[model samples]
Target: MSFFSEFREFAVKGNVVDLAVGVIIGGAFGKIVDSLVGDVIMPVIGKIVGGLDFSDYFIPLAGQTATTLAEAKKAGAVLAYGSFLSVLLNFIILAFVIFLMIKQINRLKRETPAPAPSAPPPTPEDVVLLREIRDALKR
Candidate 1:
């Protein structure tokens, strides 16, 4: 087969298509989680912790006296631990959500009973005749 045909066959497979769709959905889901952590959760946490913005909490490594993380980076090197904390929180939330979803899916799967076993097919006529002949010869 030609290379294009082979490529087409591989790309059109069910698993490949499913993986592509999963990647697209995962990207969108990551964005939602990022927004939740950055905009909603982080702000609430900051408010609870004496109204300090977590994203601005950084250690200056190059003696730069910048106040915000963005400004610090522009001035010199800095360790942005607060940004890391937000990302870590995002990961935890995403993991928890996925765990819940998987748990629910597993529960649904368990609720569905398996199909009952089918009865065996009847013996063929030829086999039955052969058996009768063997029985007669033994008699």
Candidate 2:
């Protein structure tokens, strides 16, 4: 077939479509996790850690003062590893949640063992009697 037709067939496959959907959902979930870390969780963590600001925790190679991440970006400063640490915290949380979900699924999978096959039905009474009678006659 033609190149375009081949490409169209490949793209229309269920696996490719599923992958595309998964990527989209994963991207959205990543944004949500990022927001959770940046907005909610980190603030509490910051409060617990003696009011530590994760965004402001960066070290400037050129010793510039931007105060916050936004300011740093606006001022065109050299960002250090602190942004990485923030995202790392989110990644850790997300990984931990995924691990917990997987663990629970595994536990559920282990709960019910597969049953063994049932025994065959017993022989009929008349059939057993006839067999015995035949055997006696033969003897």
Candidate 3:
């Protein structure tokens, strides 16, 4: 086959197509999760923890002392542990959501009814005749 045909065949496969679709959806899902964490959940947590922005929390390693992370970075090198914490929180939330989704899928699978067993094939004529002869002898 030609190279173009081979490439087309590989690209059009069901698994490859599904994987492409999944990557697109996953990218979108990641954006949504980022928004949820950055805009919604983090703000609420920050408010609960005295309104301190986690991303602003960092240690100045070789720069002028600054109150905010951006300022600190501009001044010199800094350790951005707060940003790491925020990312860690996002990962935990995503993992929990995925776990719940998997659990629900498993529950649905368990709820589906199983197929009924098929009936066995009929007994052979010779076997039936043998049974009849045995019954006659017993009588």
Candidate 4:
């Protein structure tokens, strides 16, 4: 077979299609998670932690000391721990969501009814007659 045909066959496979769809969905899901962390969860956390903005929290190194994180970056190297914290939170939330989804899927699988057992095939008439003859002889 030609390489193009082989490639087409591989691309048309169910697993490959499923994987592509999963990747697209996962990208969208990541955006949702990012928004959840940055817009919703982080704000609440910041409020609880004395209204501190995580993005603005950084350690200035090398250059002149600046008040804000952006200023510090402009001046010199700044360790952006706050941004790291936010990203870490986003990862944790995503992992938790995936875990819950998998758990639910497993639960659904467990709840589904198993297939019914099939009935055994009927015995042949010849076999039945032979068995009857053997029984008569024993009697």
Evaluated with lDDT, which candidate comes out highest? 1
lDDT rank order: 1, 4, 3, 2
Model 2 vs. true fold: TM = 0.70
Model 4 lDDT per residue over 32-120, tens place: 99999999999999999899888788877776578888788888898989999999999999999999999999999999999888898
Top candidate (TM-score): 4
Candidate 2 residue runs with Cα over 4 Å from true position = 70-79, 111-115, 120-139
TM-score against truth, every candidate: 0.83, 0.70, 0.81, 0.89
Q: Residue by residue across 47-100, what tens digits does model 1's lDDT show? A: 999999999989999999988999999998999999999999999999999999
Alpha carbon deviation, residue 57, candidate 3 (Å): 0.7
User: Residues 58-132, candidate 2, lDDT per residue (tens digit)?
Assistant: 665556687776666666666557678888998998898789989999999999788989898999999999999
Pitting candidate 1 against candidate 2, the one with the higher TM-score is 1
Which ten residues in a row are the worst by lDDT in model 1? Answer: 113-122
- The backbone clash count of each candidate, in order, is 0, 0, 0, 0
lDDT for every model?
Answer: 0.97, 0.85, 0.91, 0.93
Off by over 4 Å in 3: 123-139
- Rank order by TM-score, top first? 4, 1, 3, 2
